[model samples]
Target: MLEKEYDVIIIGAGVAGCVAALKLVANGKRVLLVEKLKKIGSHNSRKLDVTESQGIADITAELNLPFNGKFNRSIWYSPNANFELDSRVYDYYVLRGSDVDSFESIVSNRIKSFGGTVLTNAEITNYNFENEYVKSVVINYNNRHQVVNCKYLFFADGHHSKSLEIFGIKERPGPTFIGYGEICVNSELKAGVTHVFFDSKLAPGGYFYLGKADNGEVLSSIVINKALQGNISIKTYYQNFIAANANILKLLGKYKVKNSFVGMGKTGIISRRSLRNMALLGDAGRTMDPIFGYGVRQAIISGYMAAVSAIDCLNNKKRDLDEYEDKLNKSVFQGRETENQKFRNFIDHLNNEELDYAFKSIETIGLSTSLDDFFDNPFNNIGMLLNVTLKKPKLLTTVIIKFFLA
Candidate 1:
């Protein structure tokens, strides 16, 4: 058995944990980052194929850091509209499965360069908390037991976070959905644009996306109503999906499935209060707008914000966790709440009549934008709709009174 102490201890080594460790160590605080997986980012079900750079643009701007790399903008589909999305707006750079090894290497190298310690395959068994504050954590790594004491603990352990449960934190329910995806090489599809197919028959309560990787592989996923109910396996879903979409089937002619991934179970809007001595980031804190399925970007941002708060608390000699909570609420949760309500309203009201009206309105409006554009700037999209209504008052009244009215 071994014992150690640090200024901060972070659990989980996904992108969130890595970003937290980077922030803390860069601020000159000693950090011990532990991951239960054999390697950092191994458990991440989301492949590092596209939108890596565009995912972090906002944070890069805020921090005045250079994160520019090659990422391609793609289209996103909504039942109401098709949008052309620019990756820069989100700070994520798209890469292929072949690029994942290099990307992980770069992240690992960055951590070491910033003077941080990373221990993999270390599973946390229990935590010692006193007076609502975490004092230490017991971990078993490589057949050895150890205890790590720290002033602050950040849980980036993700949705099924055992740490948050142990700490007696309850997750608030919101919009939830489930789905799966895969990577297929030698695909006949072009390697760039993202194609989203929305049909209740295929995915039920969710949507499907087919993103082309840089290496001529297709990265696809389907979002469904909760994880367990989506009994359909990835293989079955993909085969059926290809059969249903004529365009997709034509593009995927004579393609072989190289690598496949499945993510089942409910993923939805969940928010938890960031507590004292302990803070949750990534999926452990809250999920992104499930409708958009941008959880990875949200995780990275939350992790960075959590680290900043932790550093402030440690440096200011304040035990109050309110500051961290305030930052989180003001930044991530507030926007999420609004979006959640709006999407819920939209989904609930979507029927054949509403869809017809929306499609006609979009066509008459003659808006020269894709679904990705609408999703990237929802407020602007709403404004556009309002402008259209102002010009065609009857259309606006019919949409609101017929669809929105109870």
Candidate 2:
């Protein structure tokens, strides 16, 4: 059994776990960071580089943390027209496809420098609950069993967290399949532009992307909203996507597949991100965006928020940990859950004809609207919608009905 009782015990060493440990230790609390994987951020490896939304910059500035991630502008291609987004826009930043390891390593080193203990190859097998709070955890480290007790626990074990079953926390449904791979092509692709296709035939109820990596490789991905586990494979989807997209074929006359990976994303808004003495962080608590599986920023924000909540409870004797969930939902989702759900709902019920018409309208009339303007008023755009309505009234009517239904 471990002799030292930490003030807080954080499971998992991803962005969220590391951030939590860093914050807790900085606030004079003894923290132990534990991970089941041999190394942190190993699950993040893929042919595609990492891309974060504008939230990462906001988080670093707000928390005063030292974070410098390289960013390049990217383009989002709708069905009909391509929307160019400036680098300064608060939408997203495309990280070089090759910086995944270095970025994670930097954060891990930062946590260690703060005097926090990190245990790799550690597994939390069970939990002992005292009354309504987690009292201690049984961990297996280096082929030895040990009991680690703590006043507060932060579970960042990711989407397949074992802590949820131990705590009896139910998970809600979300996105299921995301396939990533790298391909080398002998053609000149757009430097920073990320081509996104919403064709259902390519990626049913989801999207596909083709972007350039720093190493002069093309990183292509097919992200879908269904489960691809049993018999379906990512290669099958990639083949279908290539067959469906002419632009991809024209852009890259011949390509070689280098690597491939499959990932799952489920959108579950846990009503409780925390219990009495413990809280779930990152994908462990289902903090991913419902519309898109963009979660690195969410994971970071949740980790920081969980740390803040733990510190507050530790400093104030009268404070309760219930505020963690409330603060987390507000800070992370920010009332975007409902809006995102509406978008998902529309997509769920949209027929292929309606979707094709919508994309066509965007290609025809969407050229007038900028990316920022469209996001600001995606549905209620009078000028753009009116022009599309004049061309095809049925398309606009179906959109309105779907909006209300969603």
Candidate 3:
């Protein structure tokens, strides 16, 4: 058990929570980071995230951690065709685990160094809300209950967070996908290379992803539409994805499943970002790229932005932190949910043939889009988008025309 009260209490210890706590504690505030897991890196949620920024490098350099998240090549494959993006600049990725070089490990291990406390195996079962402002939380750990009060609260509770359900907050839902997959031994996929497969049959509205870590472990997963076109089993889709990608399988080494999991991938964005005393961070607010699933960068940015907003609010005697929402709106995902939702819907209706055609067309044209530039709201790359869509004008639904041209 840590202190009874603090200046700030964070509900999660993932990337966002750790970053927020680091900043707050660095500013000389008493901070507590609570994680429901038994240890910092023991949860499935604290895994790999293909980020848009150099969050890994920045944090690692600041902390003097040896981890480097540099990647060289990225491959995008349709069912029938594929395209490649060769970047000598930087295509970032962050691995989260107990490894010394992992980003989560690097940040999480330094919580106490910054004068912050991390309580693992803790569940915040209840929260006391007064006049729509959060006052405190009921923590369950070691079969005992304790109440802790704090001046400000952060909900970095992740994608499957029940905080919204408990608070009865309605989330603006997007395409929900059933992400079913496994971690396997890597013998083929070169380090610093990633593959994204677009197949309506395998992933439906979403896509299948396979990337190898520097430690020779490969993560192969597919996000398929929950309401699939055919009444096929998700298991079949997973197996088919593996079968189709023979290169992903261990050719020389014996194939083995390191771990397996099935979970829901929420593409929804919560419109209401904060209350007077509580702020939502990370996937709880769906601060991510809906199409490409780039979350870690957004999560880190939101955490830092929220910490800045918290400092301003606390200095003003805990006044309403309406500026938190404004900050979130203008930064991170940058209030682009409407545009992302439209793009998601547009891609959802696209069949396998259409996707293959789009890939071929991109191969014909070229990807002049930079990772960082496109990360700052993908709508700015409308010229490339229009070039592909104009090839098959019917693929451009009326909704797209009205949204863009209008």
> What is the C-alpha local distance difference test score of each model?
0.63, 0.69, 0.72
Across 1-406, the per-residue lDDT of candidate 3 in tens digits comes to: 5687888999888778878888787788889899998878665543455555444356545544323355768888897888887654565556666555666667876778887888899998888877777778899988899999988888998888876776567888776667766667745656777888888766787787777666666667777767563787777788887787765564314556777766565678665878777878887877766665543777777788788788887777865667878877776555578888877776777778777777776665556666445545557877776776687776556435544642
Mind giving the per-residue lDDT tens digits that candidate 2 earns over 3-122?
A: 458888998887688778877877888888888878766666544444465556766664444332333466554444454455444333222222443445556676778777887788
Distance (Å) between predicted and true CA of 85, model 3?
1.3
Regions of candidate 1 where Cα sits further than 4 Å from its true position:
1-3, 49-55, 58-73, 76-105, 227-231, 252-254, 264-271, 335-342, 348-360, 366-406
lDDT for 189 (candidate 3) = 59
Best by lDDT: 3
Q: Compare candidates 1 and 2 on lDDT and give the better one.
A: 2
Q: Give all candidate RMSDs, comma-separated.
A: 4.5, 3.6, 4.1
lDDT of 1 at 394: 61
Candidate 1 has its poorest 10 consecutive residues by lDDT at 90-99
Residue 130 lDDT (model 2): 77
